[model samples]
Target: MIQLITLDMAGTTVTDHHEVEACFAMAAQKSGLTVSDDRILAMQGLHKYFVFQTLWEEILGTTTHPEWQMRVDNSYRVFTEVLENHYLTHDITPTEGCLELFEYLHIHQIKIALTTGFYRKVCNIILEKLGWLEGLDDTHVGTASTTIQASITSDEVEKGRPHPFMIQKAMNLLHISDPQQVINVGDTPSDIQSGFAANCRLSVALSNGTHAADLLTPHNPSLLLGSLHELIPVLEDLRTRS
Candidate 1:
């Protein structure tokens, strides 16, 4: 029986299209850099630093620099501010039926854990601004903080998605040791790949993110849901069988 559902944020919990493009545009303009939309789209489902590292390498032909880091930091700071001030502030909307599905899972006593590639500060800021952390009396929803400056050490078993570290870490914190008891849900190929690598019993993919249906279909998720609202019936079926 499934005991927990681990959700990925960004393209999963929150809509990412207009907000992301706006942020990228601000960052590129502020930094006097030009990143193509194709490049940004290609780097979806990756950590911000990883995306920055790639863009920095492409634009500067080198990935590391104190000055460049500051520039990137400043640009992203402005970008986040813009997201809060404009994108989400004026038009923050949850994915279709996400709240309903979340409530359904909680009512059924299923534990929920949220993980994301975003660093702690950014995640907190967005969650706060978008009201993602508000009015929740539920204890089942757990989110793991991805320490922004933590150096990667040898003991780290995973890096990021397409690595399972984030979700695995969330489950470990939830005290759910058996991966088979957890359903990993997300909205991209990397999400599917990460859940697959984590050995989740059910890997659910949604077409609401970087990957389109054509790109995600071949990976063969345990289920592909068009809307989060659809999970209620799926979970009900799972419960009946159990």
Candidate 2:
């Protein structure tokens, strides 16, 4: 049986109306980078800093150049500002059926953990807007009365998506040792890749987020969902089979 369900924040549980991509585009433009929309979307679930670093390297054709770090720093700085302001000023809400899914997990006694590509400050901002941060400690670990059992951010780990550090850290905090007892759910390829890298029992993907089904399918997720509501039946089926 699955004991823990690790979910992605933006685009998965939280509604994302291409605002993130817009922020990235604005940052890239301000930093004088000629990145395309597809390229920006492709980097969607990665650490913001790393995304800039990689993009700068690709644009400059070498990481060793003196301007590379400066470009990365400038782009990331702008991105942070734009992203944080967007979340602070704009309306934030849970994705469709997110609350229902949370209720189902609660009833089934399955712990819910949120993992995000966002860093701490912005992540907290979104959570606060949705009131999902209530009752969580400084470390973002929730008690029995909280909405989620734990929350993990990319900044807290040495590496972000496509790496297992965040998920492993969540497992550690939740006292879950076996990946087989955990289900990873997200709406990005990096999220799915991270789950697989962590050896999760199921690396599920949602196609309605940042990327489309065609883009996420190449990552080979165990299951692909079109909406958050579809997860309940999948979990029920898993419980029965297990």
Candidate 3:
């Protein structure tokens, strides 16, 4: 049975509109590095620091730039400021059909978990702005609908996407022990890899958020949908079978 659904923030459940990439590129530019839009988009769903490290590595052509750590730290510090202000200043909203999906899962007694590449501060800003910050636990925030069982952020986990730590942590917080009972959906390759690594029953991908359908296809997701509105049928079918 699918007891829980773990969804990603930003480009997954939330409408991103490339604001994240813009912020990252802005920070990179400020830090004396030229980061391409494709490169920034490719790093979506990774921990912000790692994103900075990787970009810096590419710019310097080695992981061992003499001041690599310093540069990474400086760039990340700037990125965080830019990202936080961007979110706080902008009017953030859930992606199309995101709330409907949450409601459907709620009615079916399926738990909703929100996991994000963002650290707690930025993630909370987005959540609070969307009015989804009610019923928060010490470690995480809950949705306004009370359907969200857990919220996991990169800051709360030892690692981010492409690793199963955040998903596993959400499962743990939600009191869900079986990875087979979980479905993970996101809009990035890292999202797919993380779900697969978590051993989830369904590693679903959404194409409407960040990457294109073609960009996400090679990850071999168990299911891929262009929009969140199409999620119900896929989930209902799984419910019937399981």
Which candidate's TM-score is highest? 2
Model 3 Cα lDDT, one tens digit per residue, 1-242 = 99989999988889989999899889988998787788788889999898888878887889877988899999999999999999988888889889889889988889888899999899889878886777877767454357477889987778898999999998888788999999999999999999999999999999998999999999899899987879998888888887
Task: List per-prediction Cα lDDT, in the order shown.
Answer: 0.68, 0.92, 0.88
lDDT of 2 by residue, 1-242 (tens): 99999999999999999999999999999989899999989989999899988988998899999999989998889989999999999999899889999999988889899999899999999999898999999889997668998999999998999898899999999899999999999999999999999999999999988889999999899999998899999999988998
> Could you tell me which 10 consecutive residues in candidate 2 have the lowest summed lDDT?
137-146
List pairs with backbone clashes in candidate 2.
none
TM-score order of candidates, best first?
Answer: 2, 3, 1
Candidate 3 wrongly placed segments (more than 4 Å): 141-145
**What's the distance in Å from true for residue 92, model 1?**
2.1
Q: Candidate 3: how many backbone clashes?
A: 0
Per-candidate Cα RMSD to the true structure, in Å, reads 5.6, 0.9, 1.6
Tens digit of per-residue lDDT, candidate 1, span 93-182 = 567777787777666767766667665555555566656655432332433331111111112335777788877776665678999988
Off by over 4 Å in 1: 64-78, 129-158
- Return the clash pairs for model 3, or none: none
Give the lowest summed-lDDT range of ten residues in model 1.
Answer: 146-155
**Which of the predicted structures, 1 or 2, would earn the higher TM-score when compared with the native?**
2
